[model samples]
Target: MGSLVVFSPLFFFVLAIQMSSLMVSLSQEGFCSAPPILNAADSTAQPLYWKVTNPTLSPSHLQDLPGFTRSVYKRDHALITPESHVFSPLPDWTNTLGAFLITPAMGSHFVMYLAKMQENSKSGLPLRDVERFVFVLHGTVFLTDVSGVTHSLNVDSFAYIPPNSTHHIKCDASSTLVVFERRYSYLESHYTDLIIGSTDKQPLLETPGEVFELRKLLPTSLPYDFNIHIMDFKPGEFLNVKEVHYNQHGLLLLEGQGIYRLGDSWYPVQAGDSIWMAPFVPQWYAALGTSRSRYLLYKDVNRNPL
Candidate 1:
């Protein structure tokens, strides 16, 4: 097994529109329901039952949260599954917190999450995995890698880990971080031995590089033909034409905004968002706003056939 860590900001944009009458229409038919309570024990505590707990913090921006006089309490992002696991979706602008399990899938198996870290808690559990990537969303942390190397990562700082590499984290005296994890597949059991100077061992390309223009670069074939790449699109730029290829791909927007075309329909996309497209799904996208949009794009080209 092997791992690669490319630390960068994330971006995805999705427009969530709720019509005023939609709430009444749903209640009439009982379409919406309340979520259940969750109880979890810390690494070393008797199993305890817990319900959604709201914090007493106040909204930072008055203009952003109108009508609400104070910050409201919200429940935990995810519900506990019957199997005793936590699976939650990434949080959005309204709530700067959430987490979910990324394991139990064929392509990637492991738990991954995104949320605002607690300022008072400086320690967290470290796990053994093929690889890991942690990006700082806000605040700083003391990151220790497998080799006992330590580094300070503040907002916008990123880190990558190789397969089987052991690493731990220590948040700054008081800081918050958004963590992302990627695990290897033990089922496939086929990977080129980690080799240096080999064509397949090349590192992934990142945005704002000195040698290449990001938005203009397109992989001729899918699975990237190599490692994953993060690209950026300046306002007004776009991948206007449909791109059809054999590789499966995941695109997560890190910044800016745009409309993505997927089979006769156009979907709006922006930062803190993601989309999964396979070979059969022909898709393309274009930037839609004034801000430069960046995104994390990952594709595994040399995996065994399903």
Candidate 2:
């Protein structure tokens, strides 16, 4: 005689429920041989997750390996990438980080940097001897001048602090600023004053061929040894000619992508990229892609060759 074992319907139901739950857990953990189908229109569907193939790198870093940069340095020019820089605190500054883009070490007489300031941060004191130009990239800032006047600045706003003037900065909100500093070039009976304005309010000067437009941030007067300009180019626009002169330039691409001709080499540049064109280096630019390209250009102007 043989003995027969029997299971109840309730036991089979419980086993099926347990198997379904295990499959769901495995699928959510990316261990399932087949993933559950997701309804495209179902707004309440549970979000799916997948295990990273490489546990060492994050999602963002998985595509870009460490220690790789598009920057290049040459005898006459240098192309600097945002990844090539390390931010550090500067003297007389608190709660701020600065990445110096161009400096005397790069054969630039002027120092240019991109500064990030946290809310409530302030510049320690008024800088001495050096004239400074500050451009607001985003958020709000207040500039207190020698006369105890505090000027509120917003995006696209800029301030020119004259040499030997008392000027301090306080960030009203988290802000990004482009700062340029250099010694004032002394001239007889000529003086520079603290000027404040916004680039959006400036009139755009279209080129003769209408290829591009520019807005002069600083006055063209001789008392100012340096000049800053914002150049805007529509897609497919380009400079009319290759420019080669005694003037040196420190340029920061503000928006869009473009191809820059520096010396004899051509480099692809985009927002956050910086270029330093030394004296007599041939240079030109052409806008690429679908959007407009814009850049902040700084040049040593109104000064005689020494």
Candidate 3:
């Protein structure tokens, strides 16, 4: 008993270390927990959309400005739809003109948004429903949602609206926001036309968290596992340990910093980083700074094709 007691703490310490490493490994391997069933502990399992914080400029928030510098992936661009294009076809970030990274288009699903904005414009030109997101390296803008949620956005600020949700904006300020064009499955079309003037109450759906510009890291047409999600990890927050049966992960780092371990390589990633890993890549990481490490995380919840 004496020998056992002395070794017990060490055993637990080793176990804890192993457990943390294993947790990250599993996440990297695309081993994510299944979405809970209806009525279970987390029955809803709906996507939680985070609202953009800090609309007004405060002295304390001044230092948060990311350098005007930007990064772009140097890869061939692929056209996904009528409005969206994929690839790192833009100029390098080191250029004085700044970088231009295009996101997959927001296709015709949300045409009402563009139409409303056009109606308000002097030319009254109709806009397409497709939405696209782009990261802004500098400046600010005035943003107003359909419900009159008015606010001033600054550099690095993010804006997100639910599919079919109406919003209007004016970038006549010093703020530059990366616009992420998100095109949802449009599972329901009833709300598509409820733009700037709808008497009906907003029918809410699971919305993705709000952050700077972002687009679907994975192709929409690709019949991936039915249940996939993307989220930003705040410093130190991690996905708990769980077993996963699926493989194939698509990850993109949007902002901040972190080192992601995929397979044998520890890829140090920051804004504009992306990785496509095969099944069982044994992934995980820790945030490298006080700001949250934001990324577009995609995993096949079901179905595995070689």
Candidate 4:
């Protein structure tokens, strides 16, 4: 028989305090149980973990633990969160860190990545025969174009670099940018010019749904092989219908919370989430909270299926 060992009241109180401290530590480390999912359509519902917490975590630390993630990968679509991003070096990029979010390996026709550049860092020689688009997410940068004109870019500023262009990027401050690149698909007697603009200055085009709007980032002309657009949805608004289209998309949620349908599954998404949809994949989205939801969308355009 085991003997009864009486513990003092002081000892019990100390033990309770220790346990509480342990729980707090675990929660900070993201090892605690996830909170329950809130009702997607209830505007008054409390924000869930995916919406309120920082999604960016060191990839090395996440490797050993079973952490909660909304990210999913399928044959036709994928949802990527910053927690899974692994920063790596790209050739010719000096003092810059990059994490590729979409690539040909993921069955996408283009490559998109998040790049962080230290002050004075530069993106070296432009790729031969490839077009590039850059959107500034933070800080400032100076882009020297093929024509040797330097343009300053701040948050929300974007530039489209034409194919085989001799251009380079220099960080004026510590900066973060979203970059998209692909081989240019040439159109007979057509050519693309370098474009620079700020999203904030673009006029919004109202959609059939009064709550939805769009800002076209690139010219809608035969000379351009692809296009980027900013789509905004007011609170409680949703796509009129689920869409199944031939356009492959690489989208980055820029603001607010929403429920996104990719193929047969629906996911709760928020700012900083990236989604990739292969051609003909079914997709839709609805803004869930009180704030508006906006995303940068990319699709190949003005091209034949052949």
Candidate 5:
């Protein structure tokens, strides 16, 4: 990992209150347990795992982690899952680095992360130019956006933040959160305001047989940087129900098990697994087991190619 030497000189303003208490907490590793360790070295290893194994070699800045691979990324079977990092919630902040998962994408450059923080900890990330889309998969977290309004984000809690907005996050209990962030690309027509919501509060759009149901997390009325969706697929159902997409997708399977079609290959996927597909690549999905398959998905839309 040649890129480990360049850390952002300017870190966000966050003071991890319990330095001693924090180090001790890692031992408990409750629902927020660290990534599983691979006893052997992997050929597909990326810089992230290297840094995880060797923190002394870490660079101070945030950049493209490009961990895993450019194609399908299965968390459990990854040749290398970047070692999780403990840093500030915000990339610029150098404190309380939370253990993070980093993955690569095509159109937009995003090192996505799935973070778990202990209860009573405050994420010392100040809103800067970072555009972040956060989803709470487990537990609860309090999110304060640029408007100075704080919302309690629990399981299925989702929020979107535009660039240059000031926000803060503090947790009274242990929580697991996933963050998808990339530089904001501005276009007058695609303008959108901040969005804060939870799928629990939204109606599930479904068909008569309940074959497919979708929870639209981001507003599609006006296009913005990207769109997030939580889709539930009945067992044995396929996502290609006829419509395909011109938009690229970065997806994470939140629940259930299934076979996913990517380009020309089909791979078995389960909860905690992820996939990144390019625009126009042939793709579809089929749920497995006895229950409905659900996933929190992301897509880039509403902007023209530069």
Candidate 6:
């Protein structure tokens, strides 16, 4: 009986080990609890960003991670690398949407995408109530309206679509395009005609020697609540002043390197960088490298007081 008691504990330990191994195997074979369903428990299945905790951990009031100099947005965050890009394939089209600003997480009003579409891929502009702007970054984007008018936009080309317009976009060659959309709001006497232009073809206007002078893309006559500019800065030149404005700006750094003074902080930005600066957040920038610095700029303007 004494020998049996000693062996009994060993036998039970072996049995427990076997049971653990079986449970792990069963879990691996999909026999355990069901995994979280995509688009079931939350609006987004994958975690988009890492939360910040300064000195405390709280769900209701998380902080932006340190590394910013001084920021107006307590919720400010940035994706400093290309791998930080968030892309999901559109279900309707095989093309990919590299969305940077999505929904309420984005400030105020715009849905932006760095879209990749191959030749013969088609996409429709926002139909009834949305307006769209497409800037061709590489290759060819062919825009055709319902009236049969077609516009072929190449590298550095831009187009504006009005609200309620029946228009479609086709990529004749595999291309990368930046698509920006906003809800259409019009004022009486709003000049609503479509405009097409190219940064390569248009003469650089209103710029003084190597200074950052931005030439406007859309004619001021158009009643757009927003404006776009192809801005330039010579090497070692900066905005030259600390300024704050009521306008929010979206800047896509197209060429060269620079220092951006945003929301009371300084950041070194380079080509292919996209920046979103909220309205009234103090900002400025200076070109750093030997090459001329350039960026495609978007500014919200002419809106009634909130």
Highest lDDT against the true fold, candidate = 4
Q: Rank the candidates by lDDT, best first.
A: 4, 2, 6, 5, 1, 3
**Candidate 3 Cα deviation (angstroms), residue 166:** 7.8
Candidate achieving higher TM-score, 3 or 4? 4
Cα lDDT of model 2 by residue, 214-271, tens digit: 8998899989999899999898798997899999899988766667888767676767
Error of 1 at 169 (Å): 1.4
- How far out, in Å, is residue 104 in model 2? 0.3
* 1-306: candidate 5 lDDT, tens digit per residue: 576665331221011113322422442342123333222254134321122222211232112232422233442222112232344554543232444444442333554666656656665442455578888766778888777888988777788877777777777766667788767767666656778888878777665544678877887755467778888887778665533556756677776556665654456555566566656666767776555578777877777655
Worst 10 residues of 1 by lDDT: 47-56
Residue 242 error for model 1, in Å? Answer: 2.2
The candidate 4 region of ten consecutive residues with least summed lDDT is: 46-55
Those runs of model 5 whose alpha carbons end farther than 4 Å from true positions after fitting are 1-108, 124-128, 206-210, 241-245
- State model 3's lDDT: 0.36
Rank list by TM-score = 4, 2, 6, 5, 1, 3
**Superposition error at 221 for model 1 (Å):** 17
lDDT of 4 by residue, 132-231 (tens): 9999887789998877899999878999999888889999668888899998999788999999999978888867644688999999899998999999
Candidate 6 lDDT, 1-306, residue by residue in tens: 355435464464345445544543553454424232223244233221101101011222122322322112333423232324556764445454545443336565766667777767878557467777888876778888768899898877888887788887887667777777778667887756677888766666765444676778776654787778888888878776666877766677776666676664556565666677766777777776556678877777777747
lDDT of 1 at 10: 23
Per model, how many backbone clashes are there? 16, 0, 25, 0, 14, 0
- TM-score (C-alpha, index-matched) for candidate 6: 0.70
Cα lDDT of model 6 overall? 0.62
Q: RMSD in Å for candidate 4, one decimal?
A: 11.7
lDDT tens digits, residue span 1-306, model 1: 679876432222232112213432443443333122112233114211110011111222223335533111112111121122222423322213354423224233334444444443343433554454565545667767656878777654556554566566665354433344445544343332221121123334544423223431223333223343556667667674467766655554555556665554445544544455545456766775555566655454544657
Clashing pairs in 2: none
